[model samples]
Target: MKNVEIYIKSTCSFCVKAKNLLKQNNIKFKEIFVENSTANLSKMIKRSKKTTVPQIFINKVHIGGYEDLIIFLKKNI
Candidate 1:
Protein backbone atom coordinates (compact mmCIF):
# COMPACT_ATOMS: atom_id res chain seq x y z
CA MET A 1 0.00 0.00 0.00
CA LYS A 2 1.24 3.46 -0.91
CA ASN A 3 1.24 6.32 1.56
CA VAL A 4 -0.61 9.29 0.11
CA GLU A 5 -1.36 12.69 1.59
CA ILE A 6 -3.52 15.45 0.16
CA TYR A 7 -3.51 18.99 1.48
CA ILE A 8 -6.80 20.53 0.44
CA LYS A 9 -9.09 23.49 0.90
CA SER A 10 -12.82 22.89 1.23
CA THR A 11 -13.74 25.51 -1.36
CA CYS A 12 -11.26 24.52 -4.02
CA SER A 13 -12.69 22.97 -7.16
CA PHE A 14 -9.29 21.60 -8.07
CA CYS A 15 -9.18 19.86 -4.76
CA VAL A 16 -12.50 18.23 -5.57
CA LYS A 17 -11.19 17.14 -8.94
CA ALA A 18 -8.02 15.77 -7.42
CA LYS A 19 -9.97 13.83 -4.84
CA ASN A 20 -12.25 12.41 -7.51
CA LEU A 21 -9.21 11.31 -9.46
CA LEU A 22 -7.87 9.50 -6.45
CA LYS A 23 -11.25 7.85 -5.87
CA GLN A 24 -11.42 6.77 -9.50
CA ASN A 25 -8.03 5.19 -9.14
CA ASN A 26 -9.10 3.41 -5.97
CA ILE A 27 -6.32 5.15 -4.05
CA LYS A 28 -6.46 5.60 -0.34
CA PHE A 29 -5.21 8.90 1.02
CA LYS A 30 -5.01 11.04 4.11
CA GLU A 31 -6.60 14.46 3.63
CA ILE A 32 -5.59 17.57 5.54
CA PHE A 33 -8.22 20.26 5.31
CA VAL A 34 -6.62 23.68 5.51
CA GLU A 35 -9.61 25.73 6.38
CA ASN A 36 -9.19 28.61 8.83
CA SER A 37 -5.97 27.02 10.03
CA THR A 38 -2.93 29.08 9.24
CA ALA A 39 -0.61 26.63 10.90
CA ASN A 40 -1.73 23.78 8.65
CA LEU A 41 -1.55 25.93 5.51
CA SER A 42 1.87 27.14 6.54
CA LYS A 43 3.04 23.60 6.99
CA MET A 44 1.79 22.62 3.56
CA ILE A 45 3.41 25.65 1.93
CA LYS A 46 6.66 24.95 3.71
CA ARG A 47 6.71 21.34 2.54
CA SER A 48 5.43 21.84 -0.99
CA LYS A 49 6.44 25.46 -1.67
CA LYS A 50 3.06 25.76 -3.32
CA THR A 51 0.09 27.87 -2.30
CA THR A 52 -2.36 25.81 -4.27
CA VAL A 53 -4.96 23.53 -2.78
CA PRO A 54 -4.77 19.79 -3.35
CA GLN A 55 -1.05 19.57 -2.96
CA ILE A 56 -0.25 15.92 -3.09
CA PHE A 57 2.38 13.69 -1.61
CA ILE A 58 3.08 10.07 -2.36
CA ASN A 59 5.43 8.17 -0.08
CA LYS A 60 6.25 11.51 1.59
CA VAL A 61 7.52 13.11 -1.61
CA HIS A 62 5.75 16.20 -2.91
CA ILE A 63 4.02 15.65 -6.24
CA GLY A 64 2.42 19.13 -6.49
CA GLY A 65 -1.20 20.08 -7.37
CA TYR A 66 -3.84 18.44 -9.54
CA GLU A 67 -2.12 18.67 -12.91
CA ASP A 68 1.17 17.52 -11.52
CA LEU A 69 -0.50 14.73 -9.64
CA ILE A 70 -2.19 13.56 -12.84
CA ILE A 71 1.16 13.58 -14.63
CA PHE A 72 2.83 11.70 -11.83
CA LEU A 73 0.08 9.11 -11.76
CA LYS A 74 0.31 8.66 -15.50
CA LYS A 75 4.00 8.05 -15.25
CA ASN A 76 3.88 5.81 -12.22
CA ILE A 77 0.63 3.92 -12.74
Candidate 2:
Protein backbone atom coordinates (compact mmCIF):
# COMPACT_ATOMS: atom_id res chain seq x y z
CA MET A 1 0.00 0.00 0.00
CA LYS A 2 1.21 3.48 -0.84
CA ASN A 3 0.91 6.16 1.79
CA VAL A 4 0.34 9.13 -0.47
CA GLU A 5 0.05 12.75 0.54
CA ILE A 6 -0.60 15.74 -1.72
CA TYR A 7 -0.58 19.43 -0.93
CA ILE A 8 -2.96 21.38 -3.09
CA LYS A 9 -4.56 24.73 -3.55
CA SER A 10 -8.32 24.34 -3.98
CA THR A 11 -8.59 26.23 -7.27
CA CYS A 12 -5.50 24.98 -9.10
CA SER A 13 -6.24 23.00 -12.23
CA PHE A 14 -3.06 20.99 -11.84
CA CYS A 15 -4.16 20.05 -8.37
CA VAL A 16 -7.49 18.78 -9.66
CA LYS A 17 -5.81 16.87 -12.47
CA ALA A 18 -3.34 15.29 -10.08
CA LYS A 19 -6.13 14.24 -7.77
CA ASN A 20 -8.14 12.79 -10.65
CA LEU A 21 -5.17 10.72 -11.68
CA LEU A 22 -4.76 9.37 -8.19
CA LYS A 23 -8.45 8.52 -8.01
CA GLN A 24 -8.40 6.85 -11.43
CA ASN A 25 -5.59 4.64 -10.23
CA ASN A 26 -7.40 3.90 -7.00
CA ILE A 27 -4.54 5.40 -5.03
CA LYS A 28 -5.96 6.81 -1.86
CA PHE A 29 -4.10 9.93 -0.85
CA LYS A 30 -4.34 12.35 2.03
CA GLU A 31 -5.00 15.81 0.66
CA ILE A 32 -3.49 18.75 2.48
CA PHE A 33 -5.40 21.80 1.33
CA VAL A 34 -3.39 25.01 1.25
CA GLU A 35 -5.55 27.40 -0.71
CA ASN A 36 -7.42 28.97 2.15
CA SER A 37 -4.52 29.25 4.57
CA THR A 38 -1.04 30.74 4.36
CA ALA A 39 0.34 28.53 7.10
CA ASN A 40 -0.52 25.32 5.25
CA LEU A 41 1.05 26.67 2.07
CA SER A 42 4.22 27.52 3.95
CA LYS A 43 4.38 24.07 5.47
CA MET A 44 4.07 22.48 2.02
CA ILE A 45 6.84 24.68 0.67
CA LYS A 46 9.08 23.82 3.59
CA ARG A 47 8.43 20.12 3.24
CA SER A 48 8.77 19.91 -0.56
CA LYS A 49 10.96 22.90 -1.31
CA LYS A 50 8.44 23.89 -3.92
CA THR A 51 5.98 26.75 -3.98
CA THR A 52 3.48 24.99 -6.15
CA VAL A 53 0.22 23.23 -5.74
CA PRO A 54 -0.01 19.43 -6.09
CA GLN A 55 3.21 18.73 -4.28
CA ILE A 56 3.05 15.01 -3.91
CA PHE A 57 4.62 12.47 -1.61
CA ILE A 58 4.57 8.72 -1.46
CA ASN A 59 5.65 6.82 1.60
CA LYS A 60 6.86 10.13 3.05
CA VAL A 61 9.20 10.68 0.07
CA HIS A 62 8.84 13.94 -1.82
CA ILE A 63 7.76 13.39 -5.44
CA GLY A 64 7.55 16.88 -6.81
CA GLY A 65 4.51 18.15 -8.74
CA TYR A 66 1.85 16.77 -11.07
CA GLU A 67 4.18 16.00 -13.99
CA ASP A 68 6.57 14.25 -11.65
CA LEU A 69 3.73 12.18 -10.29
CA ILE A 70 3.00 10.97 -13.82
CA ILE A 71 6.58 9.88 -14.24
CA PHE A 72 6.55 8.15 -10.88
CA LEU A 73 3.35 6.29 -11.69
CA LYS A 74 4.65 5.26 -15.11
CA LYS A 75 7.84 3.85 -13.65
CA ASN A 76 6.38 2.29 -10.52
CA ILE A 77 2.73 1.52 -11.08
Candidate 3:
Protein backbone atom coordinates (compact mmCIF):
# COMPACT_ATOMS: atom_id res chain seq x y z
CA MET A 1 0.00 0.00 0.00
CA LYS A 2 1.17 3.47 -0.83
CA ASN A 3 1.58 6.07 1.86
CA VAL A 4 -0.81 8.93 1.15
CA GLU A 5 -0.75 12.53 2.22
CA ILE A 6 -3.38 15.16 1.42
CA TYR A 7 -3.29 18.90 1.94
CA ILE A 8 -6.73 20.39 2.37
CA LYS A 9 -8.94 23.14 3.66
CA SER A 10 -12.04 22.17 5.64
CA THR A 11 -14.59 23.98 3.49
CA CYS A 12 -13.31 22.94 0.09
CA SER A 13 -15.69 20.68 -1.81
CA PHE A 14 -12.87 19.14 -3.81
CA CYS A 15 -11.04 18.36 -0.60
CA VAL A 16 -14.16 16.66 0.76
CA LYS A 17 -14.50 14.66 -2.43
CA ALA A 18 -10.88 13.59 -2.39
CA LYS A 19 -11.13 12.42 1.22
CA ASN A 20 -14.37 10.56 0.57
CA LEU A 21 -12.82 8.72 -2.35
CA LEU A 22 -9.86 7.72 -0.25
CA LYS A 23 -12.15 6.47 2.50
CA GLN A 24 -14.25 4.47 0.06
CA ASN A 25 -11.12 2.83 -1.24
CA ASN A 26 -9.86 2.14 2.28
CA ILE A 27 -6.64 4.08 1.64
CA LYS A 28 -5.19 5.45 4.82
CA PHE A 29 -3.84 8.96 4.54
CA LYS A 30 -2.35 11.82 6.46
CA GLU A 31 -4.37 15.02 6.24
CA ILE A 32 -2.60 18.34 6.48
CA PHE A 33 -4.94 21.27 6.97
CA VAL A 34 -3.76 24.42 5.23
CA GLU A 35 -6.72 26.55 6.20
CA ASN A 36 -5.20 29.09 8.58
CA SER A 37 -1.43 28.89 8.67
CA THR A 38 0.64 30.59 6.00
CA ALA A 39 3.49 28.24 6.76
CA ASN A 40 1.45 25.14 5.98
CA LEU A 41 0.12 26.74 2.80
CA SER A 42 3.65 27.63 1.76
CA LYS A 43 4.80 24.10 2.46
CA MET A 44 2.06 22.70 0.25
CA ILE A 45 2.92 25.08 -2.57
CA LYS A 46 6.61 24.27 -2.29
CA ARG A 47 5.91 20.55 -2.39
CA SER A 48 3.10 20.48 -4.97
CA LYS A 49 4.01 23.46 -7.13
CA LYS A 50 0.32 24.25 -6.81
CA THR A 51 -1.68 26.73 -4.77
CA THR A 52 -4.80 24.66 -4.71
CA VAL A 53 -6.76 22.71 -2.17
CA PRO A 54 -6.57 18.93 -2.06
CA GLN A 55 -2.97 18.60 -3.11
CA ILE A 56 -2.08 14.98 -2.75
CA PHE A 57 1.04 12.87 -2.51
CA ILE A 58 1.59 9.16 -2.68
CA ASN A 59 4.81 7.82 -1.21
CA LYS A 60 6.35 11.32 -1.46
CA VAL A 61 5.45 11.69 -5.14
CA HIS A 62 3.39 14.71 -6.09
CA ILE A 63 0.04 13.52 -7.41
CA GLY A 64 -1.46 16.98 -7.77
CA GLY A 65 -5.00 18.02 -6.74
CA TYR A 66 -8.32 16.18 -6.64
CA GLU A 67 -8.70 15.56 -10.37
CA ASP A 68 -5.18 14.31 -10.70
CA LEU A 69 -5.71 12.07 -7.69
CA ILE A 70 -8.74 10.48 -9.36
CA ILE A 71 -6.75 9.75 -12.48
CA PHE A 72 -3.91 8.24 -10.51
CA LEU A 73 -6.25 6.08 -8.44
CA LYS A 74 -7.97 4.78 -11.55
CA LYS A 75 -4.70 3.81 -13.16
CA ASN A 76 -3.16 2.25 -10.09
CA ILE A 77 -6.21 0.51 -8.68
Best by lDDT: 3
Runs off by more than 4 Å, candidate 2: none
> How much does candidate 1 score in TM-score?
0.94
- Candidate 2 vs. true structure, TM-score: 0.93
User: What digit string (tens of lDDT, one per residue) describes model 1 on residues 1-77?
Assistant: 39999999889999999999999999999999888889989999999998889899999999999999889889988
TM-score of every model? 0.94, 0.93, 0.95
Candidate 1 Cα misplacement greater than 4 A, ranges:
none
TM-score of 3: 0.95
Q: Model-by-model lDDT, in order?
A: 0.92, 0.92, 0.93
Q: How far is candidate 1 from the true structure (C-alpha RMSD, Å)?
A: 0.9
lDDT of 3 by residue, 1-77 (tens): 47899999999999999999999999999999999989999999999889989999999999998899889989999
Clashes per model (N, Cα, C within 3 A): 0, 0, 0
Model 2 agreement with the true structure over 1-77: per-residue lDDT tens digits: 37999999888999999999999999999999998889988999899988988999999999999999999999998
All candidates in order of TM-score, best leading: 3, 1, 2
> Which candidate number maximizes TM-score?
3
Q: Which residue ranges in model 3 land beyond 4 Å of their true spot?
A: none
